[model samples]
Target: MEIEIFTLCDHAQDFNGKLVIVGTFDSISSSVYPFTHAACSLAGRLRFSEKESGVHEFKIKLIDEEGIELYPAIEGNIDVSKSVANYSTINFAINLGNLEFKKPGKYAIELYIDNEWQKGLPINVIKQ
Candidate 1:
């Protein structure tokens, strides 16, 4: 399996196998210690080869610089079917609401597939 696209965005959706993403960002600015983002989305597209077809477990986690979890991990299973092409692509968009940042610092959005770490997306919360 391969990650074709992974990002944090203001909005995202999977429209009939197409990924529509808007306002992709990696940083947030705030003037307070604890700031809440009202809404956002974690979007991605994963490609699976014929040999990798089947049920796959996936997890998404948000962790602060100190390695503390900011929220509960999102977990789910994806079923990949064998396609006539060399690979099949899966698009996903996870909507998040009221995401709180306790402090200004760096954070990571991590993705795991089949219990193996796949990618880490860095985000910075800066005090204004």
Candidate 2:
């Protein structure tokens, strides 16, 4: 299995087999310590081999510069099966609602598949 697309966006969805993504971002500028992000979305496509079909665990983490989790990690499952013919392309839309940041520094949106780290979206919170 492999990740073809992983992004942090304002909005994303799988609309009629289309992965619609908007406002892709990698940084947040805030003037306060306890900054609140109204909403953020994780959009991506997971590609699997033809024979790979099972229920796998998918996780997301918001971590600080010190590699400490700043919030409760998001845990979920991804069902992979041969829905099509050649391969499987699973489109996912994960929304992080009302997330708060206590400090301005480096942060990341980490992706894990079956308890293994697969990808990371690096984000910087800048105080201005």
Candidate 3:
């Protein structure tokens, strides 16, 4: 089971710039996806910094070709502080093998930040 983790940096920081955001994940299984990459626009990417103040919201959903899969189970909001000026770490406990998939294939899971709509990265699950 893999729970893909993403980051929400400041909207004024450079791509290579370092920043921090309070990250949290609620998972269906104890297994979790690894922290992947950050999703943002070219402008958003270059402007994101850890030294910003505000409460950013993030959401996750599991879906498939038929449509939405897992319902909203976990929801939380983290406050991003520019004072930290460094990357903070968080983790989600998930059990991937327990998920009831409509079919054995790739599943669509999404992650959201700051009440903005975002797509979930692809995750492969093999039924044993």
Candidate 4:
């Protein structure tokens, strides 16, 4: 399972162009799983924190339909704290080759904003 997370700054408060976050996953064999959104703020403050800093937290809980976590084979996290003022776009990638994705189906991705369910990224894994 190769997962790529690309975040585009659509309607930010004071963003000019946009920001992109890309992530990849490999070796995923799970049928279903859960995912959370990556939070970002322009005020140099975290959405779940009060500390003043140019940083944001990008986190997600990967789980199966039966409420089982399938993130042991592979995992990763990236922090764009200090370099928030340089680039307008960011990319993140993760590989889940340990899990091994075998078939093709509908996967669930839950994106949250300020602790709320916003949307999901449905991925179809086909054999190549």
RMSD of each: 0.6, 1.3, 11.8, 11.3
Candidate 4 lDDT over 1-128, as tens digits, reads 11223222212232342332333332223334332223321111122222323333344444444434445412233343433453323333232223333344444444443354444444444433
TM per candidate comes to 0.98, 0.93, 0.47, 0.35
Error of 1 at 46 (Å): 0.4
- Residue-level lDDT tens digits of model 2 in 1-128: 98999999999989987899999999998898799999989999989887778888988898999999988898988788776686788898888788888989999989999999999999989998
Candidate 3, residues 8-42, lDDT tens digits: the string is: 22222332444233332322222334322233211
| Candidate maximizing lDDT | 1
lDDT of each: 0.95, 0.89, 0.42, 0.33
> Candidate 1 — which residues are off by over 4 angstroms?
none
Any idea how many clashes model 1 has? Answer: 0
Task: Report the poorest 10 consecutive residues by lDDT, candidate 3.
Answer: 39-48
Q: Between the candidate structures 1 and 3, which one is better when assessed by TM-score?
A: 1
Rate residue 76 of model 4 by lDDT: 32
Q: Give the TM-score of candidate 2.
A: 0.93
In each prediction, how many residue pairs overlap at the backbone (N, C-alpha, C within less than 3 A)?
Answer: 0, 0, 22, 38
